[model samples]
Target: MKRIQSGTLRALSNKEEYFETTDLQRSIRQGYASLLSGEIEMPTPFDMGALIGPILNEGTESEFRAELTRRIRRFIHNRHPPLNVDVETVERHLIRRLLRTRKGQTTLSGIGVESSGSSQDWLQGIAPWRAVRDAQKEHSSVLASLGDNTRADIPKNILSHSMASVCGTLSLVPSADISELRSALGPVRTVSERHTQRIVKYLHEHTDWVHKHKSLLGREAPRSILRQRYRAVGMTLLAIWPLKEAIRKWMEDNPTTHLRYAMGQIVRSGQYPSAINDTLARISLIGSGTDGRSAPAGPSGLVTWWQHSA
Candidate 1:
């Protein structure tokens, strides 16, 4: 590579910034389902791939970083606006997951592969991945059931079962670290580690793809509050230091567009906002910690705390 300098270097470094799934996508398919445990979800069957990434940490005896990256890249670009999987994104997922595994955190799929010294409630609370098994079966059934246009179909218990299985099986409760956690959980039968994580790999390959299905498969999918709660998150990135002049000029020039899409949005663009200046001024006037939160108000905005508020 030829030597590049200044702004070019900055742009290159900023190329693969963090991409959160919640922030992407504007439209959603209204229906889909699978026949998991006799319940159907709706349009197309529910694809668990969105909730869970395309790859699972299948406890394979393989070395960590290298194998993980290779598998991840394969999955992200499986469809639609394929994921540009970068080392940073991979590291973000890996580090967070590794920490969670070591710390015994809960996963979306209620399958906790944790062990609290082999306690009754702790281990019993966890369930095996039955959903994944079902998905494998439905994949066969649905293909046989439908033809070209499958726009209308209740989602069969297809991806849900398989994802549940893969997620549940691959997830390990948090211990000291990855290796220690693995050791505590026992031997490294990575391949036979309760169904090797091919499902995750598959999901990765087909990210953002809405599989077409028959009209008859339509049933009830996520709706109302649950749907709203899990709605796609839209983030507004702001520039650093916020020159606030050129943008102001642009807004003045093109008033209609800027007012709706840009203003009052979350300023996650690595910059301080003009709106919070007063809040900072007041904090400084009172000399910090008035809210009983913490010190250093510049970077402190919203801190979500979960406790016994009841």
Candidate 2:
């Protein structure tokens, strides 16, 4: 390989610089290039391979990154006035996911074996990948029943059943990480209804609840969850810094996005405390130590917390 000069090296996007750099970036870049060159058609049913096939030949994961990218790219090209796709945000999500599996493991396919094998065999060989594959299968079926369109309107009964199915499949995975929860819950985002968005929020809260009580539940807390907690704790150092006025201004200027999304932007924007510590603490206490009110059990408790908190 030709030697590349350190002085000449630079990040392709802003978010790329923040994440731990990975060789997978090259493959992802290649995939996008192939799409732009019309070398391949975007896959329907949104197979994982179509997006990452430049590196891995196959996968069965049901994560949204691939499909979301496809939609954003098409929007950019097809919009009459042109759309400004947030390539950095897309790349961040992709990199975080691709970097999850060990660097050299063949499991980087983002799902287990390309072909189906006996469930027992999969469970014995690669439980993590098997769990992801199964959860995706569940999520996919639910989305397909809704016409497989992100913008489709969803009914309450179908939505509830879909949530149950996805979360139930997820519960099968032992000590699932945030990425796995993300994979299981991602399809809900496909339907652009507020109900679906609320579903996503509830799932996040479920994850938070599980993570907080992992010891009692006989599971390990996901690293991402720990990081959020630690980040909240770390923000105390900047408590003395004056940021309330600036944040208020930010909220006023950006009124349309979800508060969580906007806070994430503020936190990642720079060296200021974004007041997410309170939110994290609230999520951490979702299912336990309540104010003498009986909330529904399990994931429904998560939904109840979201409703009450909102």
Compare the candidates by lDDT and give the number of the best one: 2
> Residue by residue across 175-235, what tens digits does model 2's lDDT show?
3444554553333112233443444444344223123223445556432222222111111
Give candidate 1 misplaced runs (Cα > 4 Å): 1-133, 141-167, 173-188, 192-199, 206-310
Off by over 4 Å in 2: 1-155, 158-165, 183-310
- For candidate 1, the per-residue lDDT at 84 reads 40
Q: What is the alpha-carbon lDDT for the whole of candidate 2?
A: 0.34
Estimate the TM-score of every prediction.
0.17, 0.18
Question: How large is the C-alpha RMSD of every model relative to the true structure?
Answer: 28.2, 23.3
Report model 2's TM-score to 2 decimal places.
0.18
